[model samples]
Target: MKAIFDDRQWHHDPKHFMANGKVLPSPEQPERITRLRHGAEAAGCDFIAPKDAGLGPIAALHSPEYVTFLKNIYTRWQRIEGAGEEVIPNIHPANRSDNYPKSAVGQAGFHQADTACPIGKGTWEAAYWSAQSAVTGADLLADGARAGYALCRPPGHHAYGDLAGGFCFLNNAGIAAERLRASGLRAAILDVDVHHGNGTQGIFYDRDDVLTVSIHADPARFYPFFWGHGNERGAGRGIGYNLNLPLARGTGDDAYLKVLDTALERVAAFGADVVVVALGLDAYVGDPFKGLAITTPGFGRIGAAIAGLGLPTLFVQEGGYLCDELGENLTAALTGFEGA
Candidate 1:
C-alpha cells in the first residue's frame, strides 16, 4: 500500500501536556514518526509526500473561523506578557452556547477542548501537513487505489470541528470522509482508537453522507470523559447512522474482535461505498495507556477482519505512543490486511 506522509509533521514536537493535575512530558512526540516509518518500510510500503490540497479539503469539515484560529493562535498568544512556552487554554466561557471570546486567551480556551493539545511554534505547519497527508490519501482512493495509508502524526480523530483535544487539531479522518462524499460516494469512518473519536463523531453527527462508528474504552471513566456512550445515536437525519461501542477497561483481543464484528455489520447495513479505518495501535497491550490488551498478533486479526468488509479502505493513523513493538505492530496490521 502507498503510505502518505510529510517530514513537516515532525516539526510540531510538543514538550509537555497536563495530566494528573501536573505538567508532564508529552507522549505525542516527533520520535513516533521514526518508529512508524520503520514499520511501513518493513511492510514494503512505498512512501510518498503529500501534495498540498490547500484549505479547501479541511474547510469542508471544519468551520472557517476555527481554521483561522488554529493558523493564527500561536502568534496571538505570543503577545501575552506572561504566556508559557506553549499556548494552553486556561479559561473557558461559562456559556459556550451564546458567547465567543475575542481575546487570544479566550479564543484559545474556546477552540482548544483541553490541555492535551498545546499549540507551539511548529504546530500549525505540522498539523497543516498532517491534514494534507490524509487528503492526499483520499485523492488516491478517489482516483482508484483500492487502499492507502495516511501516516498522520499529531493524530486527528480527537479534534472536533472547532475544538482541538487529545493531541489532535484538524480532524484528518473527517476531512478524508468529506472528500469521499464530495465524489458522490457514501463513506463511513470506523475509529478503533483507544479513546473515542469525539471529533469525527461530532462532525458527522447530524449528517447522513458519512457514517461514524467508534469502539473504544468507555468514556464514562476514560480519557474523553464526556461523549462516548451506547445511546449517542445520531440526531435528525443522522439518527441510527452513528454508533458507539464502549468496552470495559483491560479488555483483550477476543472481546475486541467480537465488538468489531458488530461494527462491521453496521457498516455493511449502511451500504457504504468506502471505509476509513481510524487506525490506532494505542490499544496494543504494550502501549502506555493500558486501557485494552490487544496483542501484536491481535492487531493482525483486527486488520484481517476490517479487510473482510470488501470495500475501498483508507487507513489513517491516530494514536500509538513510543514502544519497542510500535513498528512491528503497524507492520502486522498492514501485512494482515494484505494477506487477507
Candidate 2:
C-alpha cells in the first residue's frame, strides 16, 4: 500500500474545530498523519505526496452552490468588522425555519451542519488539497495500484454535498468515488468510521450508480444522531444501493466483525468494481472519545477483510485522534492487508 499525506494539514487545531462548546485542543492533530506515516514506513510500504488535480472531481459529488459557499465564505466573513475569527454558527437552522440568513454570516448558519467544523481563512485551501490527496489515491487505483491510503485530515465522511460538519469541509470518500465514476467504473464506499458517514450517504442516496455502505456506532445513541438508521436504505432509483449497519455502543471486535462481514457480503452482491474504505481508527479500544472496544490486534483482521474484497481500493483516512497506539493499530491493519 502506498500512503498519501500532507504534513501541513490538520483539523484538530483550535482554529480548525470547536467542540464541547469551546476551543478544545485538536484531536485531529498533525500527529494523526505522522502516526500513519510512521506506520507505513515500519510496515515497508510506499508513501506518496498528493498532486493537485483541481476541483472538477469534487464538484461531481458536491453541490456547486455549497462548494462556492465554502470557497468564498471565509473571505466574505472576514470583511465583517470584529468577525476576525473562524466562522461558526451560534444559531443553528433548527433555531429557525428553513428560511435562514442569506448573507455570508447567515449563510454560515445554512451551510454549516454542526459546530464541530469551524472554518478559518485558509480552510478551503487545506480541505481542497486534503481532498486532492484522496483524488490522487483514486487516480492511483484507476492507474493500476491494488490499494493505497489517503491520510486526509479535516475528515470528510461527515460532510455532505454542501454542508460541513464533524470537522469536514469536503466529502473525501464521496469525491474519490466520483472520480472513479467519471472514469466509467462503478464504485462502492465502505465507511468504517465510528461515526456514521452522514455526508457520503446523503451524496449517493438518490443515485443508483454508486453504492454507499457504512458501519458505525448506532446513531440513536451517538453523534449525528438524526441519521444512520437501518430504515434509510435509499430513495428512487437508489432504493437498495445504500446500507447502514449501526452497531450498539460498546460493540466489540467479534460482534463488530460479524456485522461488518454481513455488510461486506451485501457489497459484494452489489457487483462493485472498485471500493473506497473510509478508514477511521477512532473505534480502537483505547480511543478516548468512544466506548467501542475494538482491540488493537483486531485492526489486522479489519484490514484483511476489506482487502478480501479483491477490488481496487482507496483507503481514505477519517476520524482517528491522537493516541499512543494509533500508529501501532494502523501498522497491524496494513500489515495484515499485505500478508493477506
Q: Name the candidate that leads on lDDT.
A: 1
Task: Give per-residue CA lDDT, model 2, range 113-225, as digits (tens).
Answer: 86678887668877887899999999999898898888787689999887888878899999999999898888999998899999999888999999999999898978889
Residues 1-340, candidate 1: write the lDDT tens digits: 9999999999997876887899889999899999999998888789999999989999988889999999999998898998888999888766558588689998998988888899999999999999999999999999989899999998999998888999999999999999988988889999999999999998899988799999999899998998989999999999998999999998999999999999999999999989999999999998988888899999999989999999889999999999999999999998888889
**Looking at model 1, which ten-residue stretch has the lowest summed lDDT?**
92-101
For residue 328, give model 1's deviation from the true position in Å.
1.0
Top candidate (TM-score): 1
Error of 1 at 129 (Å): 0.6
List the candidate 1 regions with Cα displacement exceeding 4 Å.
none
